[model samples]
Target: MRIRGLTVTFGEKRVLDGFSLDLPDQGVTALSGPSGCGKTTLLRVLAGLQRPEAGRVEGLKPEEAVLLFQENRLFPWRTVEQHLTDVAALSGGMARRLALVRALALGAQGCRWLLLDEPFTGVDQRRAEGLMEAVRGLRVPVLLCAHESHTLSLADRVVPLEGPPLRRREGEGP
Candidate 1:
């Protein structure tokens, strides 16, 4: 997706200011920064969860994107299987199960585009690595927010965010 001179604010705090980015169509892109840098806000904007006060975003088809937020956001009443089944009707039951298995392997579950916010938060290294490996195997576009270098390396590109500005770091190519 492409964000052109986007601007966003929450009350008086300017979260993003004339920010622009060209996200690749495939592979993973990591968004990283110090605390309260608006990385999450940018992801919300891309997912249509939050609207930018001013700017243009293009090249993303609404239906094709899925977000895995920082909060589990899982229906506590539903089992993990149920959650995956709920969103995977298009992929069919078998496909959904496979996806779930993959997610569990990665310490996650439930969708493509995989907008993971602090995916490794609180998890031990071994488990986190397992989860990261699972995410890598999905072969779908991924946007991740992380602080650890190991986690950041899993992405195809790591973009550092500073308030409204963003910078890109090279990663192992597809």
Candidate 2:
């Protein structure tokens, strides 16, 4: 999506202020920023959850995107297999792996894009690597927000954010 003059305000606090950005046609692009800098907000915008007061976003629709948050979206009582059959068939050891299996399954469902917010927060290094690889093999594009350097390496590019709400800083590639 192409964002022009995007503004998100909560009461008087500006969450996003006249921000502008462009999501590429394909590939992974990681977004990094300090706390409360609007990285998650940006993902919500892409997911059509929160609307900017003034902005024009081209080439994005809620239906075309999926926002996978860090917290589990699964039911504690329901086996991963019940929600998704493929998760059941992911060889063994799925009991210890959640991020990789879930991500692979979601990406396999087919969508225009996925906005992942630190999808591997609780996962181990080894498991996170496998998840990153699984995410890498996805057919759709991904925009990720992660703090782990190892995990961030999985992205095709990085957009390091700074300032309140966030403005893309220089020195980071496009």
Candidate 3:
């Protein structure tokens, strides 16, 4: 996907100021950055959940991308077999893992891109790696946000970001 001159400003904080990025046609691409640096905002914009003030995203449709948010948004009452049950019954890490699995399953159905926002936040490193292996096997492309260096390393490409007016780190673009 190609994002050109994206500008999203929330009050006084300009989350994305003329930000642009080119996502590869295949494989996993991870966005690595500090907190409040617009990583989540960028993913939200890509998923069409948050509209940008300016710019356009090419080659991706809202319906074609599935966003797995930073928090596992599983319902507490629903019991979807082994993958999901009562939300209170599972640990934080277990919930996050289950959420990942569910998102992957949904994304595989017809989605073109799997956009994940810190999907491994509560999961351990070992288990996170295992989950990443599963992600790498997907036929569709992926754009995910990751804070851990190890997690970023698992991606085929990593885009390091910075600033309240988020921008790709100098000399770090594909």
Model 1, 38-62: lDDT tens digits are 8888778877888888988888644
> Could you estimate the TM-score for every candidate?
0.73, 0.83, 0.91
lDDT of 3 by residue, 46-163 (tens): 9999999999999999899989989888765555564433323677898888889888888877899999999888888899889988887777899999998878878888988988
By TM-score, the better pick of 1 and 3 is 3
In candidate 2, list every pair of residues with a backbone clash. Answer: none
Q: Which of 2 and 3 is the better model by TM-score?
A: 3
How far off is residue 56 in model 1, in Å?
1.5
Clashing pairs in 1: 106-131
Cα lDDT over the full model 2 = 0.75
lDDT of each: 0.67, 0.75, 0.87
lDDT (C-alpha) at residue 57 in model 1: 81
Instruction: Indicate the residue-level lDDT of 46 in model 2.
Output: 78
The TM-score between candidate 2 and the true structure equals 0.83
